[model samples]
Target: MTLPAVLRSAAYPYRANSLNLFRLILAAAVLFAHSWYIAGRGTGPSLQGENLGGWAVAGFFVLSGFLITRSRLRSTPGDYLLHRVARIYPAFVVVLVVTAAVFAPIALLVETGSLQGYLTTPVTPLQYMWGNLPLEIQHYNIGATLQSVPYPGAWNGSLWTLFYEFLCYLVVWVLGFLAVVRRSPVVVGALFLVSVAVYAALGVAQRGGLDESFALFARLLPFFLGGSAVFYLVERWGTNLIFGVASLAAAVGLIAAIPHWGGQVAAPCLAYGLLSLSAVIPQPGWIAKNDISYGFYIYAWPVQQLTVLFGGAQWGMIVYLAITVVVTAAFAWLSWVLVERPVMLAIRERRAKGSTRSEQLPGDIQPAAGT
Candidate 1:
């Protein structure tokens, strides 16, 4: 197909595109945004009236909703659930185990003079693992992990979002299983509207009553749903330069007009902006080849903390960010090659052995797909 024709085709099969690189950049953006506070600096600058980290995270959800919803359409509930579990849990479990068995003990011993004392603490390794379960686990400090650092106590501040990411995945799965997404595109669209209403309500409550995390989730849910809506929009209207331009324009307008309400208007605009950019830009070959965004996201905070511990938080933000990028990227590459990629391959291979051909649907982002 011609370039314009591909742009307008809902089934253009963009698995060949640069989503992996795009997501890696988003992950790096989060790391960059977090450097300020982690390095004992105050809040950093915002971009186009939104916090950079917040914007990067919302972009993640938008991309996830777009991709995962697409995956759901071509999967049985069993396969869909399995794919999610394989994708999220293995690396997560590995990180948790390492944190508990390795990092936590070291940190606790640093805090107290005794490993025995660390063991005697109430937060056992088992509790540490168990507490971060089902979803929304607050098992952050296993007896003072990273307690000596600038951003002390929180081993991984980035973790809280994974819970929400999984929650959004489950929402998509449940909605998909119920045919709310597949059989009734209108229902999915309506849910987007409902999400906006919830976001608005939470925005009001955040000023007076709601917890900040709760408010954040409420604010982000609309973006996830908005991504799903975009999938249907592509299916119905197909992608086009005109629509892409309009989406970008609308996003700019929203950022200017509704700078409050925790990005209620900005979410859909972000989704469209992401999609439009992908549509218009050519993804680099090397970036599209390997998916390291997940590893980067999960590992960046801890690595940054470690940097602060060793190098001192007095380092300038640029130096901190520069050091962090090099270290975190190395760790992320290792994670992809050693943990995430291998586990996913084993799962896929095991499943493949049972069947004659690959069971995954077209355009279903595999576990290796960035974010």
Candidate 2:
């Protein structure tokens, strides 16, 4: 059968596309946005009261939701959970270790002239790495290592979102196991609606009291759900340029009209529009082959802090950003090459070995991917 103008399955296949390039851009955008703060200026500029980094993160959630949902629907429960853990935890664990052992010590040596008293500090390097091993950022600084930096105490400010992102993953997992996503996506769509309602109720909830984590979850949940909605819609209707444009127009209007929360409400359209765009845009072979966006994001803040320790804060925003791009990109490349890709490839190979051709689905759809 001839496909629609463009097949959603084709645009959002498990691998190979401009999505990687888009993710790279988003990751760098975070680095660029954070340069101001790392250099002691402040949040440089923002849209609708959210910083550029914040918007980039929201964009990440939208894409992740779509991609991760696809992952769940296509894999076994055990395999899906393992892939999620392997994808997120190993690199995260590596970054934490690097921040604590390498960067923090360097920060101490630069500040106090020795790593002599380091182990006796309040939260020692081991403690710092161990405390946050679970993805929840329980420790933001290794003792007093980052206290002198411009942002002060937060070594990896970008890390807090990982906890929320994992939670979103688990949420999708639970929904997938119940057949809610594949069988009754309208319920998934409704969850997005409820999250949006919570978004509208946030101001009132803050005055009346509400958990910060839940509030943050409410903020990101719609985007994730919207992504899931987009996946289903695209699968059902395929992609059309006109619909993509119209969806983007609607998303833009919501984003402009609503203040801080409009983007969450606009997520499905935004995700669809962007995914549709991805169908048309061709990605570079280099970026399409290797995904370092996750590494770039996780490593950026600490690298920036190190840059500050060496007096990068005085170099001005442009210089700081330039240096950061080079250093962080290198780290990201190493992460994909050394840790993330190898670990994932190993796990994928193991799973493939365990499965047989008879068990495969007729039109087995592949996940787009987040990390």
Candidate 3:
């Protein structure tokens, strides 16, 4: 069944509420982790727990896969793309522009000794603006030194993940189209696996060793695949006790194994497990009503960057947690009001208009369709 029909199937709408809560929690986890990074706590048990950020990002991937695939199944490809673009790009571009024009200058002034360095030194400006781009497509550092200017020198690191995310959307769109046309899940799955393998190999090669490569692998493909697995299970079996238990098991395994992987290599696995767990668990009252994962994820890095610039000190865990909550909540509100809500409403309106137009068209003009 196509994703739209599956959603309209009335078999599992409530089940997704649990996943929404999971997303909000995961967003908090990511904020905590990034806060630790900002505080320069790069090692030890405190930071180890913070590794859950990877799990949160992975959960987002899974959510995206499930939701996007479902939508594609229901709508025409053009409509699907339009909806997805509207939902993601407006907020993303706004954030990107703000980070570049406003935050980048401020960060550069703080990091370098003088504002003159921002204009004069090529490296400094490049690094500062690199974080401003939506996807972080340009690598900031080359070899032992930063190739671009390092504005917000130690900030906005989480923006790196968006690159992988945009790529995932494209991959899903192409694979989904192929699946719809070919009527073969096996073919789509096989293509996805091959892409993952190739990217994993490239990550290994670029890093020059297994240990380094593993970190890249953890960041990209595994989390996405984990999400794909969730879509497959939910679509094929429906929401049931058995599949829920298996998802729980997978989540536990991933969490337990993440610490062993070391460095960033453990991140994706942690994300996969947490996301799986969310799928199975019941929604908490707070998050069920106001899920803010997307807000949390996008806002945390910039907030931390600003905090660090203001000389926020590294203290105990409690202090860090307090600061993180304050910053995350503030950004979450902004994201909801300025970014998420407006864009979502616009997309829905456009989709509704398109649907009305299609319905108004003559029945004889419609093409024969099947799924």
Candidate 2 lDDT, tens digit per residue, 104-205? 888988888878868778787888888898878888877767777778878888888888888988998899868556876788899999889988889888
Per-residue C-alpha lDDT of model 3 across residues 100-212, encoded as one tens digit per residue: 55666666555554455444454444454554455543533211221123132433566566656656556666766665523545654565465455554565556676564
Clashes counted in candidate 1 amount to 0
Instruction: Tell me the tens digit of each residue's lDDT in model 1 across 1-371.
Output: 45655345443345555567678888988888888888878767785556678778877888787778877786667767777887777777777777778767766565665677565566667777788765466777676456667678776777777777777778888898674557667887788888888776765777777797777677677878888877877656555656667776777677666645545556666676677677657766766656778888878877788778766456677787888899888888877788877877786777777643324532253332222
Ranking by TM-score: 2, 1, 3
The lDDT of model 2 is 0.78
Which ten contiguous residues of candidate 2 have the minimum total lDDT? 362-371
Candidate 1 wrongly placed segments (more than 4 Å): 1-11, 47-50, 105-116, 122-126, 203-214, 354-371
TM-score of each: 0.86, 0.91, 0.70
lDDT, residue 35, model 3: 62
| Predicted structure 3, TM vs. truth | 0.70
List runs of model 3 lying over 4 Å from the truth: 1-10, 14-16, 44-50, 101-134, 139-152, 179-184, 195-219, 254-291, 356-371
The whole-model lDDT of each prediction reads 0.71, 0.78, 0.52
Per-residue error for 321 in candidate 3, Å, reads: 2.2
Question: Which candidate should be chosen as best, given TM-score against the real structure?
Answer: 2
Scanning candidate 3 in windows of ten residues, the lowest lDDT window is: 362-371
